[model samples]
Target: MVRYVVIGGGIVGLATAHRITIDQPDATVVVLEKEPRVAAHQTGHNSGVIHAGVYYKPGSLKAGMCRAGQASMLEFCAEHGIDARVTGKLIVATDAAELPRLRALHERSVANGLPVDLIDGDQAREYEPHVAAVAALHVASTGIVDYAEVCRVLADLVTKGGGEVRLGARVTGLRRDGATTVVETTGGAFVADRLVNCAGLHADRIARLAGLTPSARIIPFRGEYYELRADRRDLVRGLIYPVPDPQFPFLGVHLTRMVDGSVHAGPNAVLALAREGYGWGRVKPRDIVDEVAWPGLWRLARRHWAYGLTEVRRSLSRKRFAASLARLVPGITTADIVRSGAGVRAQAIAADGALVDDFLIEQAPGQVHVLNAPSPAATSSLEIAKHIVARFDE
Candidate 1:
């Protein structure tokens, strides 16, 4: 029997394993997760937004995958009795300069073949009354779902489909023998006919272990968020976003109505000192050292120093974060928010200081490595898995 190994049991890894088992029933699959359980990193700590493929360029990998993955995720949720819905989101343009960007976004959405409604000032207000904007693009299919729960269900599906999911199994090394790829982990060595590296944070390292030189490096961008205090939750009826600056990759701070009825805001893009750092207190010295030593880090810093500094300032000041929130919803105040949580974005950067805007992958003799899968990756997890498998087949 053919045996396959999937590293990283986050959403991407779990979903990949799930697809493999479903497609090849008789094949043996093993999922190795470094953490004690699944979804410990990006998947567990994401915005939980089921993206509607609005922010990407038409025909880009992100656009295609998010659109298809949105539908597949909903179907998988319904089949597994998961909680996911199309609560919809509004991308608001509050000022004159942002208006053109908003219009361009609407056109891009249409070009991507996504369902969208272009709303005027009054029409936008009708959808989200408290949301402040001159015009907006309403993506009716966007929604929120608990990705951690979905990861659990995917783990269960993999097991039921006769696959083994090994947790706390950190991959330490890789070697290709005559016919099988040897994966050396903290637990032991496992040999498989093929390997898949879906490590969200450490994907590049995993690729190098398998003897493939990936061109890009994973730079961590921490996205800090705050939850509106219970008393002020009503300020947001649903998701509210800004007309993201085209120059930078981040979509700016905005309000998101979570599935649990609470509202969250702010996710400023700051360089993360630690790959898994979720707070000011969670910095990892090794991760910090590695980032500083990378040329790509220096390049990005030199180019976006001012923006990066601004994000750092916002990270330290809750009042500043609330001010950004006020741009989208004037009703929000500093007192209305409590430091909810934060997530690290694994942004892939090139050697020349350019941010990798599209999905990047590298393949070796016996392994497939996902170098970059940020932003809507949680939304595009299902489709990405299928794409990875297709590449492996080729």
Candidate 2:
């Protein structure tokens, strides 16, 4: 029987393992997760938005995966009695300067086959009454779901499909022994015909453990958030987003209505001192040293220091952060918000300082490494699994 071992028990990895078991039922599958539970990193720390494929380029892996995955995710959630909502999103252009980029996004979304409408300020206000916008793109397919619940269900499916998910199994090394791959983990060693690395925060390190050089280094960016007070939830009708700056990968600070009726706002991206650093105080020495020593970090900083400094100020000042949100929803105030937890994104940056945009997957002898799967990755997990499994055929 074909033996496969998937490392890093995030949603994508779990989905990959589950897909493998379904495709090759007689094959043995094992998932090794360093955390005690699944999706403890990017998957669990996400905004839980089911992306509608509007922001991505047409024909790209993200566009296809997001479109297909959202449908699959909805079906899966329904079958499992999970809470999922198709809360349409509004990508608002607040000023005349943003209209061009907003129109470009509309064109791209149409090319990607997503149903989007360009609505005027009055129409935009009709959707989200508090939003201040000159024009907006109403993306009807955008939605949200609890990805952690999805991961739990996927783990159960893997087990029921005759696969094994081993928690607290940190993979330390990988070596090819003849046609088999030997995975040395904290729990124990496992022999497999193939290995898949889905380690989110430490993905680059995992590639090194397997003696493969990854294309980019994972730079952790802490996305700090604030939640709307319960009484002030009406300020946001649904997901309200800014027309993202084309030069940056981040979608600017905006409002998101969670599945449980709570509204969240602002996830300002700033370089984290630690890979898993949720707060400024939770710094790790090694993570800091690695980040400082990386040449790409300097290159990136040199180019974006102006924006970087602004983000740092916003992080330190509650008023500054609230002001950013007010640009989208003019009614929002600092008192209406409460400091919430943060999530660190494993953003991959090239030596040239360009952030890796698309899903990055690399392969070596008997091993596959997911170097960069950020943002909509949770929404794209199932389709990405299908893509990963197809790599074996090539």
Candidate 3:
């Protein structure tokens, strides 16, 4: 039996641990989480949208994993009696300027074999009456669920498989001895045959701890959100997204109808002061120093300063945030929004200044590091686990 030690208690790590035990019933597994509870970082703070492989390049892992993962996620949710819904999504082009990108996304969607269709403004409005669009891409497979709940269920599955999840166990170091890998955590040390690094926010640091020099550095970007007021929640029927700007890596602010029946709007992406900084006030001095010290950050900023300025403006002004959202849904206004929590994304940037666009998994002597897993990661967790397990088996 292969003994496994998975770092981080997010959905990906939990899924990996659970899949390992499932594939090898007699295998021993241990999941180490820094927080008292699971999904404390990106997994819990996410918008909870199950992406439909629309935005990613065709043939990329994101596209394939998303398609397969969406199915697996729904199946898993159904089997576990979790609340998950295929609310569908519309990627609307508000004006002629966005038509080219919209068509491009449609082509990618079709190439990826996703269930999608190009619709005119009338059809778009039929799906979401509040949206203002000249054209739209209707993705039937898009869905929403509380991913944190999914993490909880995964932890239970891991436990049921004879695995142990140690809470408040922060991994401080990693060392290799013969064929065994020793993981040093705050709670204690655990030795195993293999180590899987799924530490979403601190993945890079974890790689270094394992004596691997990762090619990319993680830069945290805080996506601030606002919830629609109870009375104004009717403005969004389901997920309504804008044709994202090609220059920016972020999916522009969109209106998402969550599983709990509330609508969320405007996740303006801006540089977070800390790795887990959910708000502007939650700053870490070391994080700021590291960010400023990274040349890749400056290179990225210099390239996209104008777009970054817009995001900063929206982040600071409620009216500006609502106005950006209004471009997609005309009925939305600043008053219709209320303060909501933010999610910090661990976006990886290479030394050459380019942002890593796809999922990156690096394998060394006895370790595997998940370097970049941004949006759709929660949606693709199960499929990713399968791929990682395949690598281990090979």
Candidate 4:
């Protein structure tokens, strides 16, 4: 039987291993996660929005995978008895300047084969009564779910299929002995005929450990959020987003009504001090050194210093953050929200200083490395698993 070792227990890794168990039932699949539980990092800390292929470029991997994955995710939830609701979304244009971009986004969403409608402010108000907008794109497929629960189910399925999920197994080193790979971890050493790296924030470092020079370096960007006060939850019915700034990868601060009926708002993206940095106080010297050493980080900062500064400012000031959110929902005020948890995004930057927009996966003789997967990754987890497993055939 083929022995496979998968690193990281995030949704993608667990989903990938679960797919293997289904496709290659006889294969011995093992998942190694440093954290004590699955979905501890990006998977658990996200906004839980099931993306509907609204923002991705037409014909891109993100657009295709997200579109297909949304259907698969909903199906999986149904089969597993998970709570997933299709509450739909509104991409509002608060100002006239944003109207053109909103219209362009509508056209792009149409090109991506999404069922989206460009509606006027009056029509937009019908969907979200409190939202302020001159125009909006109604994306009916966007939804929300508890992804941590999904990952838990995926882990259970893998174990039920005779696979093992080794938690608290932090990988320390990697070496090859002919066709076999020896993975040394904190838990114990394991041998694998094939290795998959889905290490999220630390993926690039894991690639280097496997002796592969990845095209880009993983830079963590902390997204800070605030949730609306319990009494003020009625201000947002579903999801309310702004016409995203096309220059950056961040979707801008908006409001999302989570599955638990709480409205979360304001996730301003700032350069994280460490890979898993969730707040300003959490910092690691090595992560800082790594960012400084990478030429791409410097180049990226030079190109978008102003945008970066704005994000930093927003991160520091709650009032500023609330103001940005007010543009989408006029009823929201600084007093209406409280500081919520944060998530760090593992953004990949190329040597040329370009932000890797799409999902990036690379392959070697007996290994696969997921270099960059952010945002819609949770939504596309199942499809990403299929895509990764299909690589074995190639």
Candidate 5:
């Protein structure tokens, strides 16, 4: 029987394994995760907003996958009895300067074939009474769910389908032996007919380990968040976002009403010292060396130094963070929010100093490497699995 080895236990890896089990029931599938449990990193740390395909560029991989993934994700949730809610989202433009960008986003949304409406401030107020907006794009299909729960369910399904998910199995090396690839791990070595690297933050490293040169390097960006106090959660009924600056890839700090009904805010992007760095205090020398050694890092910094400084300032001060949110909802104040957890994004930067804005996947002989998949990845996890599995046949 054919055997496949998958590295990383995030949503993508588990979903890929599950797809393999379903598509090739006789194949032996093994999943290797360094952490002791599934969803220990990115999948567990995100804000859990199901994207409505509003922000991606038209005709991009993200736009197509996200639109299809939303429906597949909801169907899976319904079949598995996972609690998910269609909360809808509002992209608000508080000032005249932002109106044009908001309008452009509306046109892009329409082009992407999403159900979006451009509403005046009064109409936006009907949805979110406290929101301050000159105009807003209301996307009715956006939703929220606990992705960690989704990961857990995917793990269960993989196991039930005869796949093995081994935790605490960190990969140390990779080699090719004849027609098979040998994956060396702390747990032991396993040989497989094919290998899939969904290592998220460590994807570039994994690609190099597999004897392939990737087009970009993964740069870690820590996204710090804040949650409203229990009493203040009522201020947000759903998701409320600001008009994103077109130059930057991040969708600036915004408020999201989670599955549990708590409101989360402020995920300002800042450079991380380590691939898994969740805070300023969590620094690793090797990770720092990797960043400094890359020419793209310096080039990227030179271009966005001003914006980076602003993000750092926001990360350091709760008052400044709250002030940014207050632009959307006038009543929110520093006293209403408390420091919550943070997540590190595995953003890819090309050698030319440009941020890779699309889902990047690299394939080589007997191996596939997922180089970049940041936001909307969780929302698009199922469809991404199908896409990857189809490659084996190709």
Candidate 6:
């Protein structure tokens, strides 16, 4: 039997198993994933940005891990022959009303130890020749990479270190077996001395299956993106973003340059009726019922109904979505964009309607469960795994 079983074959789980193999060479470790490959969900579907600890509150796990993760990620990418680049990002304010919030965000970035440059409209334009802004904050460290590649590297190291990665292994139930745990999966039964759960979309459900109550439920938020037509790609030289609404969790639509050298201009954040719902073409009745029946969700809607309504409008109407994206990249129009793809963010909401703004991990005598890991998770995966193993020492 393996000494440890890391559930969820996403980057975190793979990283966790890799760490165990490195530290506990004699202990057998295995990672069980439901999909046929690693990083099939949040990790693979990410925007691949190396977040610079800009948006997080200082001293929290998000801030600490993201800061450490940025360094670690750059180092790993350099050492592992990954094609990651430090393409700097801009947080732009297109109107005077947003300038104050932009300044506050810059302050927060500085507090989090990120070097930020405050610039006027002219300086902002210099960073991205086509970007629009009354003022902006240039964060030089924010970069982009294919996280799917990072996950692959972690899996390779884990397996070569004597850890096993079992794909197509859908875990169905969990029960304590004497001093060990029996993880029942669709592939077969696997027993281990300890368990770690990092299931992204199904995190809460998996926690409840293990007899733990995660204070929040994983509410899926679908971010629909659009790619600029090849002819308009030059219109965006680099990343262009808007001053996010401080009251809400979603960062508004903006322009982003992908690692593939293509420019994507979109991502309207809207509530997804289904957890894995990628398109308006897909829906799960149970997912919708669960969301609508939650009092906390209703409370959240009441607090931001107007914004929510607008998000739906932008989602259903490409013209409105294009206009929102045009706030930062004025060259874009409805005709200049086409449907690219969508990524589902596993946003965890509390019973009290508050968004869990930081990473949440819980531990029992023989298990650890990551309940909520928000944005920058992909950037912070390796660092997060290091932290997870360190917790065992505590």
lDDT of each: 0.89, 0.91, 0.92, 0.94, 0.94, 0.86
lDDT (tens digit, per residue) of candidate 1 on 139-223 = 9999899999999999999999999999999999998898789999998999988899999889987887888878988888889
Clash count for each candidate, listed in order shown: 0, 0, 0, 0, 0, 0
The TM-score of candidate 6 is 0.97
Better of 5 and 6 by lDDT: 5
TM-score of 3: 0.98
lDDT of 5 by residue, 8-111 (tens): 99999999999999999999999999999999998999999999999999999899999999999999999999999898999999999999999999999999
Lowest lDDT block of 10, candidate 1: 359-368
Q: After the best TM-score superposition of candidate 3, give how far the Cα of residue 188 lies from its true spot, in angstroms.
A: 0.5
Task: TM-score each candidate.
Answer: 0.98, 0.98, 0.98, 0.99, 0.99, 0.97
- Per-residue error for 247 in candidate 2, Å, reads 1.7
lDDT of 5 at 122: 98
Ten-residue region with minimum lDDT total, candidate 4: 325-334
What residue runs in model 3 are displaced by over 4 Å at the alpha carbon? Answer: none
Across residues 1-394, which tens digit of lDDT does each residue of candidate 2 receive?
9899999899999999999999999999999999999989788877889999888878888889999998998988999999999989999998999999999999999999888999999999999988999999999999999999999999999999999999999887888799988999999999989888888889999998888878899999999999999999999989999998777778888889999898988799999999999999989999989788778889999999999999999999999999999999889888999998899999998888888888899998778899999978899999999888888778
Please state the error at residue 67 of candidate 6 in Å.
1.0
- Residue pairs with clashing backbones, model 6: none
Off by over 4 Å in 4: none
Better of 1 and 5 by TM-score: 5
Q: State, as a TM-score between 0 and 1, how close model 1 is to the true structure.
A: 0.98
The Cα error of candidate 1 at residue 184, in Å, is: 1.0
- lDDT, residue 181, model 5: 95
